[model samples]
Target: MTANVLTIAGTDPSGGAGIQADIKAMSALGAYACSVVTAVVAQNTCGVRSFQALSPDFVADQIDAVLDDVRIDAVKIGMISNAGIAEAVADRLRHHGAGNIVLDPVMVAKSGHALLDPEAVSAVREALVPLARVITPNLPEAAVLLGREDDWTVQAMQAALPDLLALGSDYVLLKGGHLEGEHSTDLLTGPKGTRALKAPRIATTNDHGTGCTLSSAIAALLPHHDMPEAVARAKAYLHAALAESDALDVGQGHGPVHHFHALWGSGV
Candidate 1:
């Protein structure tokens, strides 16, 4: 059976992140992609200049339209710009009993511009985190979510994982790329316990949409019903993407990972 995945996120004109990246990642991984745009961003590899948020009602309508027609196997949520949109999405998903919702708490861009409003962080915690099957937060994002300093080490990340789990997600995949490590390690914690995914960090500037891609990849694999397996596969997929990105040049600044790397046989 074909698995249909929905991504509720912002639109990135650069196509490196947000709904565009989610769609590409899901489709590349052999799943059909559907999207509900929560915001429209004027962004590029350089950074985000500005963004326009969609109305909450319209966002809800998009969700309803997709869910009414398709057998959505999983959902991946990205940059929700405000509390209202977050609340609307949470309400709709809860009402529909949406399963396998992967929430990627996108706070700042790769260039350090804040994508999510500072005040909206609380809304995401109250409204969306509880409904998510898994929450994927990078080191900086995890620090923001935990209300701690950004200089968290691997031990600190491990210590904070439980608090993230306490926020009501079935699982939390704490991405450790921002930590100063030779190998990027992502810690996945859930009802089954903790599993660590370790991979050699590919030295490349083309890592713009990594968080979006990884979470969407997880969403694509969720129909198989093994969260740990899905996370492992997604990490492998991400590694391949980074490795394949060596040849392609999408932008002058930090470019996007080659998501179609597997199709071209360039990925490991």
Candidate 2:
């Protein structure tokens, strides 16, 4: 059976991140993709210029409309810019009994623009984090959620496990992409225990929408694979995308990963 994956996120006109990237990743992985937009963002591969969020009630309505009709096998959530939207998403997901939910704590953009409101951080931490099957947060995002300084090493990430687990999610995938090293590692911890999923740091400047791609890939794979396997596979897919990102020249500042690297063949 084809798995149906829904993405609740904002827009990226550049098609490298947010709803665009989510749909691409899900479809690339052979899952049926659905979307509910939370915001309309004006951004290119370079950076975010501006964004206007939708009303919380309308966001909830969109969720309801989709869940009422479609059998969503899994969901990937990103870029909830405010507290009201966060609460609305959480409430609607709970109301629908949504499963295999993958939450990517999207706080900042690649150009260092703040995508999430300061106040919404707490709302997502409290309302959304607890409901996710797996929450994928980068170092800075994890630090903000925990109200602490960003971690710099694998040991620090390991040390923060107790608190990260306290967020109440079934699994926490703490990404170490910001850490300076030859290998980028992510720590996944849950009832089964903690383990590191590492991948070679691809030498590429076109890494736009990496978080969205990874989380959506996992959500797409969740229906058929276990948490660990899904995450591992997602990491591999992102790595390949990044490795092949230089094939296209989308923008001047930063380019997008080749989401169809395998399907489209080389020289894309």
Candidate 3:
């Protein structure tokens, strides 16, 4: 069967992040990509200038249009900017009973712009978080979910495993890239066990779409493998993208990872 991956996210006009990155990442991994935009973000690698979120009904209509026709193998969700949209997503996906869902809790942008509304945070936690098969949250996002400060280290992430596991997700991948270190380590905890996945940190400013890429890659790989295996494979793919990222100059600020590194050849 042909694999298909569906992404629900906001638009990044610059094409370095959000729905753009999600599509690129999934398609690069040999999955047919489909998307439903929940918001339109006027942003770049530098920062988010502003954004306009679509109505919850519009978002649901898009979801229904896609789900009504295509048989999606997996779904990658990111950048739900409000509570109404979050609840809509949760309700509809449950109605369809979509499995192999990967949710990236995108609270803030790499450029320090807040992508999610504070009031909507509760809605996502209450409605969407539990429906996800895998929840991928960065340190700061995890902190926001836990109602704490954004200060996180590998130790801190490990210590917070119990709290994350309690959020009803069968698996949680706490990203450790924001921590100052020589390695980018991600802690993946699940109902089965815990794993510390480590990859050498690629030294480059081109890391704008990393979170979206990783989660989309996970979604693309999930139909073929288990959650842990899918995550590990996705990490390996992300490592290659990051390591070979220096070639693309998409913007003046933090650039995007090289999605076609294997085919185009790396500049580094």
Best by lDDT: 2
TM-scores for every candidate against the unseen true structure? 0.97, 0.99, 0.98
- Candidate 2 — which residues are off by over 4 angstroms? none
lDDT per residue for candidate 1 within 1-268, as digits (tens), equals 8899999999889888888899999989999999999999998887888999999999999999988888899999999988889999998898888999999999888888888888999999989999888999998888888898889887888899899999999999999998777898899999988988899989999998999999999999999759998999998998999888876768788898988887876524
Q: 141-217 in candidate 3: lDDT tens per residue? A: 99989998888777889999889879888899999988887888999999788999999888898998999999999
Single out the weakest 10-residue window by summed lDDT for candidate 1.
Answer: 259-268
Q: Is candidate 1 or candidate 2 better by TM-score?
A: 2
Q: Lowest summed lDDT over 10 consecutive residues: which window, candidate 2?
A: 149-158
How do these models rank on TM-score, best leading?
2, 3, 1
Off by over 4 Å in 3: none
Whole-model alpha-carbon lDDT for candidate 2: 0.94
Candidate 1 structure lDDT: 0.91
Better of 1 and 2 by lDDT: 2
Encode model 2's per-residue lDDT on 1-268: one tens digit a residue. 9999999999999999999999999999999999999999999988999999999999999999999999999999999999999999999999999999999999999899999999999999999999999999999998999999864688999888779889889999999999998999899999999989989898888999999999999999999999999999999999999999988889987888889999987785
Backbone clash count for every predicted candidate, in the order shown: 0, 0, 0
For each candidate in turn, give its C-alpha RMSD to the true structure in angstroms. 1.5, 0.8, 1.1
Those runs of model 1 whose alpha carbons end farther than 4 Å from true positions after fitting are none
